[model samples]
Target chain A: MGKINIIKKLSFTIVILLSSFLFIHIVNSQAELTSPTYKIVDPTVDSGGGRSESTSYSMLSSQGGALDDARLLSASYRIGSGFPNGIQANVPIFRCAESSTDSGSTNCINFPNANGAQGECGIPGCYDRFKVEINPSGNPIDTLYLVAIYNEDTNTQYFLQSDHTLDTTYDINDYMTICELEGKDTRTGSGCETGGDPNWDLSLQSSNVLNANANTNYTVKARALHGDFTESDWGSEAALTTESPTLVFDIDIGTTSAADTDGPYNISFGNLTAGVVNTPANQIWLDLGTNMQNGMTTYVKDLYTGLYNGTDTIPSQSEDLSVDAGSDGGFGLQIGSVAEDALGPLLEGTTYDLATNNIGTVTTSDTEIFSTDTLSTNVGPITNGRGGIILKALAVITTPGGVYTDTLTFTMIGNP
Target chain B: MNKFLFYTIFIFCTVFTFSNVNAQETGAVPTLFNTEPLEIPSEDNLDLIAPIVANEQINIESSIKLSPAVINLERGSSYLLKIENNTNVTKEFTIVKSAFEITSDRKLKKIDDVLEEKLVNELEESIIIEDELLVIEPYQFKNVSIEYKQPILNYLNGVIVKQRDLLENSDENQSKLDFSGQLASVIIDPTLTREQLDQLKNTITIEPEKSFFGIALNSKFKIKTNISNNSAKLLKISGDITLYDGETRIDSKSLTQNYPSYFYPNDEVSIEFDFNKDERSVFNQIGERSAVKTLKINGEVVQISDEIYVLPYKILVLLILLLSTLMITSFLGYRYYKSPKKSK
Candidate 1:
């Protein structure tokens, strides 16, 4: 009876040892299983001997073997998906590449091996391309990426799959391998075989994403499905910002003046002979520049209602002065023609066009004189922004002459 | 005898000619002076005819920038006005002070001549500038200190900083287009408090329209109400005249076309309303009825009420004539009855 108990105990010990070994092996295998790697691809770059707008995700075996049998069960991404927060939606990656095609194809394809050999994908840096489409509706161009699902049971990769085909119906037993590509080969003749492509870059558009406004920041992240439909942790967050808008404004003397030192601001209409129209030699020039979408406007007001010398005054006209010599005595301003600088095509106010020689009435109240509807070029060395203002005055025979003067204030506002 | 006469005539002619030449040379008898042709004043000769107005020849350039275009000056306080010379050459600016008032049309009416001598002197003394002349170097700036002393009243005044031509002579004929000086409005804060401002309302006087005594015979009648701003502060006056017949409002009309935007101190505006044919008829009816009529003139600060009697003098005259006729007839009849009966 003692011998029999010893035999049973030895057998129990062997069984325990074998069970422990099996459990440790399973745990080790799980610990070695790593999440897939993901990244955005720049269409402008010639990576993998091709250019395309796509997000690349790798799902290669640990042995660096082909992904012919190892397939992706599902793939998804989210914009402004910073770390710690879970990705809420899935974006499908379309299968644009056929067996005989290269990287130029519009669909997702696997990157070749270091030797530039085909059908030998799944090495490190050999990732499958997920196509991203740019949405042009918003101002900053929001982007939407497509998610793809590969059914390992059917041994088929689905192309152009919509959100409805996410394949969540599959059981967790449907396991798959996930891999990532880290580097691209950049060689002249050898092509992705000898060295990585130095020009290869990544952008938000390549990942099918964009900002809603100029000068705004955005974050992106991606998660991958692995064996048993287990989702790996999200990759490192990718942060970027959109470009900013610019606006510039300046004031200088119009080049039409005989003397540069005399003005850009002040205009003088010399002695007014009775029944004669007199215009200043120089005009006041206003320069403006902006990248604003809505454009800008300029307004002007006068300190005095008319040109006054002591009690004698030359009154401001109610309407645009006829400006005819020997007409009524009046004072006003005329907006000259538009002289475009680098970026131009500014417009004059409807009331004060110099073509008609109609010196528009300037009262104590503010009046619009010049405006523009879009981005304008900076005031260049060659007279730009727009033309200046020409002061016009006419004195009748009865106008008592002294030193007639008035001050005008110009104001400009921009809409960005 | 003919030879003797010829010689005598020749001698006399020669003597007269020599005597005239000698007289002209000796400055005793002057020959009718040969007059040079007069040159008519034309465009070419305008300069000779009259000294060209300096302003006409001047091409005024705005080279200087004056900041703080408007300021509120408190009594016993000082403010500095910055003047920037944008030119490379040295520039001189002259400060000119002028008294100004805002007109009803919102125009700046220079009242330099309208202000009393005492007020003008006070204004000149109250706002004292360190220097009326400012000389700034190339690309330099200068500040003019304006000190407001104890001011007697609030006034809207202007400080005109004119760019002086240092290169030109001061002669009036030396034409130089001077830079039309930039005007900085100096609004002197009133020395009076809110209570004082309210007290000024009592000084406003409104004269009622003249009472209509005679019958309303003309097609139209004039009702004039004179509103005077007797206070020291500027006021905006606007009101209406209401005609009442025994407390029953009959008619009302605006005293003036519009309220004077600025009713300056010591200024009077006449508010006249002309009664049309319909209005005259209403008054005539009132006169015939002998009803109590009142004219009330209302101003912004003052109101005046006066009784106007529009009596029907024509009807009264007719009634008197009728009574006299009846008396005369009765007297004649009595006399006829009392005296010797000469009845027929």
Candidate 2:
């Protein structure tokens, strides 16, 4: 029993030692990371409009403290994906003060606490969230990086200017920023950050400026400045793209390089039955693309020919021939939809779906077109950069046919 | 459990919260001044012609004239000299630059110590003197924009132009024309103030100010400049800023970056460059820290506006501790709320 008592006492001593060590560890750990821990949870910056002034964006720190102010250490816009350190160091670094309290006000961030729903620094009276500004690149910046460092002033920040942060060492419980050789004014925003926001991007309004155009795609990335020498991990990347890729859009008549002005868009549907429709001569290629995502469309109209006999004009009731753009790459033009574009006199009961009769298949609509900057456009029944339209003349069994012809206008209208 | 968790969170806020600071440096380095996004000029418009007229001494019977009968130029600047072709016919004129002989007479003009010199030698070493004959098209003039990349010996210079017509592409027979020895004298003058080029000075004005240069800390300074463009078209211009310590020239930075900026007419742009001495500092260190008495910017129109200040390290030490204590307490209270038993 006496031996048992000794063991018990030893166990108790070990427990006490462990507790003391853990308590010290918690305190020490806090101090080590106390040099303003932060993250640009979302570092993807998107410049809505291409301007020459400071473009703004904000990110509230998730768990760390407040960033009273941040100096723009460096910001550069480079082409391709790789970034060179200080490549654009010559560009002016604009100041972006923390906007933890009011969205509109530049003042108000001072504390470091996380509340239930609101971030201690992300919301009110805290430095967890920072409002950053990008200085003038002057040129249109579509794909680039913006590095900003958070400035910490222990005196102005936490009222510890008396604490010589750089030259002196403090206990784990202290709350002073240890900048270079100064007291409370610790400068932590001087490091070079190479790993950027993978999704960093910028899209310009016009191609004339900085080679940015409606078809261009840009990426943007950023990171938060940490300790007097540390930098937080890069945040998420922002993308700047409005149009679908030029490769996704495809159109082919008989040839891929034909244009609307070419005479290759002609289709002739032989005699049609009262209840049976004849096949089309040829089908127009298509990939009716998505809106702005793909691009705009243009339909060029040359002329419309009314169906006529060698001598007499056909009656309006007998005009039953019609044609329009195909629905898919394989299908020809829809021969006789009720609303189909047409000009002729024939039986009222005859209609043709280009795919079924096979005179000419109606592929998808030509929504996939190119922007105006494209040089030497392709000429085809359907072209991504340039395009043309083809029409076929169809006739009913009772209708008179002397080779009635009508011109189909191919039009391309772009997205806003 | 709730009590422990709440206390833990509260402790987290107290021990692990708040601000981080950044670093910066400044000192005047030759800075490149860039223009804000202004209107882009038409393709037809070009930079200053140095002379307003295409030809100054054209014979009444001749169809060409060198714009400025007499020319004055600055060092390390790009100049656009025009060879005018006034005739309606599509004519091509070939200029022999080797034939550009310097006159024996030396004239004197003084604007600065660096700009005082003789005229004859300036002509012989003129950067604008090309090796081949320059061609000028009909009705449209051609300009030779020579950019002097090196420092030049200050002097006044003179050159008389001689030309021949290229008869290859034209059907007109080669006619004997004595277009030689016309006095198109150039005064390769760097003196821009008293002797004026009204075409540029009257159209563009640049006012520069050195806001401040730091002493002990990492070198830093702000160059605040206002460039006013009064002409009709946008200006695509690049300039350099330099630092000088009493007569010793320090360093220079080419404002060639962010090139071809559009400077619209009637626009005044405010440019502030907060520069720091890292590798780009123009001034050498006095004792690990660079000190300078005068800062010079030689780009655009040179007018110096200087501001200097030293940092105050004393007040930074004597902080109102009570005021700081009060503010810190208030902020800490707001950051760490009383965690209820239910918050776990």
Candidate 3:
């Protein structure tokens, strides 16, 4: 009887051990995880190695090997070696499949390793860099690495910006939402990626997204997904933000100017915060930091820009905004005067006083109405960027037939 | 009597008659033609003109010393009366022709000239006014100037007559005011019949002078200018006066009311005027001696003043006599006083 009791105890012990072993095998040990990372490590570079529409950028030192050709670094996830597979372990990845909407919802896609690659990023073996060897080793997992690309030189978002005025450091749209790589495609969280997760090939061919504005911050993290219905702690956040020596800022014509008889009224300038967090408005006020002690200048000289066909060394397009009144429609434009009740054109919205800055007089002749006059020495602070006008058109009924319109531009230089 | 002598006498008579006719046409009396026949025998070299005689020259000068100087007029022609100064000395004349007033605007610009008195030139040159007063310097002749017909639209002239003459209480002054307007009437009608124009012509009779042509040196005289409503119609008259001291002219320089003598036709008015001329004939002179050459009274007036008085050489002679008598008396007294025997 004592012998029988010993045998039974042994059987119970073996059963418990086997069951625990099965449980351990199914639950991939994932203890530490870190946030993801995405940015243009080098901000001064253009994708085509040229300063033009194709100018792209990249933050990854050796993105796609030899990071020199890259203009952007796709978002990536990483974790500590505490996970069962360690850093070299394979894992699931999710990405924003579409551009964000006004409501901030996103469509996401789950990358699968269908192309014979070990992990989720793509078929190019970028994901295979992290894996757990079959056996015969002390720890199979070497490093946890999810693949990311450095191909943002499409000139769509931030990288090779269409406007050559500024180079992009980072774009919020570049940072995509990532799921814990659930079974198949059961993404739980609602974020800036796809509203509904879709099946994506492990070796994806393209990012297929309309990127975000520059200089915006993105929140990104990663974790391990186990088949045993267990999940590791979220990985360290991908310390996103283009690795630019300077901040990547954006400007937009936030509130369009209202149509007016004389000219446009309030023209507000504000920051362009894409599907990211709600950024503050009024970028104009921010642009003109303290006081614009210097004058707001115009493009052409006061003589007659309209009369000339081409331009001199000083291109009028860069220096000035040509407000053209098509047909026989004269764009009667005049600058502001310092006189409180000046009879001159009323330019510069109420927020700004063009008179505070100097400008040319209003004219209807076949001459471009532009003035490079400087502001008064004592002109006070300039809160907003420039956009306002005063019309010198013929009286309403007396004006010739046709919808008179003008295409003007505002070239602003920071006031010292 | 021989036939040739008879023919000569007849021819001389005829020539003299024609000369008288010309003198009358010139508003001058033919005193030369009316002279008594010379008692000298006639000769072929005698020229046979009435103004010539044996070693003597007939005088030919401005006459009309008589009271009234009549001016004839015709329709559609500017009424003109050519009067000569007659005197050899420079004479200034003032002829005030009542002109219908027309409205006009005037502008003035002030000029500053440090070297000379500031003079202004009128921008507009149309000389339209209510009166056209002319000054005739010696030997110069002038026509009585009047322009445009008064539509009699305003009756302002009649009002002026009522305000002065009609309102005055003196009957003599009232009579003097009666004939004091332009004696010429205008007929402005493109559609008027010939008979109608004739009737309008008879309606205005310009019988200029009336009676008093008498004068004295340094004396006041009366010129009876008759507007004479000889046409039997009531008339309005206005007149002005101008003065001259030989060649120099004196202007009234009045901006308005240039003519103050307005009259209403109630009989007539004898307005008296005084002029003084001091005789100083000792100095050498190139022309005839006269203080005034001609006094051209015109327009609503009958006649200008006529020279009825002449200064003689008596005053110059008197001054000499008085000096001589004083000198003689002084000499006699001195001689008497100097007798030494009487004093001792």
Strongest candidate by TM-score: 1
Tens digits of per-residue lDDT for model 3, A1-416:
99867766766665566556544533322112334764322221111221212147321221111123333222322211111222222332223221111111212223332221111211111100111101101111221222232223332322211111112332222222222112122223322134334433221221221122222233333333323333333322222221100100011223223211111112211221222211112211111111111222222122222212123111112111223222121212333322211111112322223332122332111122221112342232122222333322221222322222222222122111
Judged by lDDT, which candidate is best?
1
Tens digits of per-residue lDDT for model 1 on A233-333? 34323232322222222334544623244322344566677777676665665554332223345556675667877687777664445544435588777
Q: Count the backbone clashes (under 3 Å) in each candidate.
A: 25, 83, 56
**Model 3: per-residue Cα lDDT over B171-249, one tens digit each:** 3211010101111111121222333223221111111122223222222223222222222222223333333334533
Which one wins by lDDT: 2 or 3? Answer: 2
What lDDT score is found at residue A91 in candidate 3?
35
Q: Residue-wise lDDT of candidate 2 within A1-416, one digit each (tens)? A: 99867766765665566556656655443342122665322122111111112247332211111111122112322111101111222222222222222223332122122221012111111111122233222312222323322122222111111111111122222221111111111112322111132221111000101211222233322332323322223432322221211111222334332312111223444443333433443444332221121122322212212334345332222122332122111112232321101111111111122233333321111111122211233111111222222333333345543544333323222211
Q: Candidate 1 vs candidate 3: which has greater lDDT? A: 1
Question: Where in model 3 is the C-alpha error above 4 Å?
Answer: A1-92, A95-147, A150-256, A260-352, A355-386, A391-416, B1-344
Between candidates 1 and 2, the lDDT winner: 1
Sorted by TM-score (best first), the order is 1, 2, 3
Whole-model alpha-carbon lDDT for candidate 2: 0.28
What is the alpha-carbon lDDT for the whole of candidate 3?
0.24
Cα error, candidate 2, residue B77 (Å): 30
lDDT of each: 0.41, 0.28, 0.24
User: Candidate 1 lDDT, tens digit per residue, B12-34?
Assistant: 55655443333222221111121
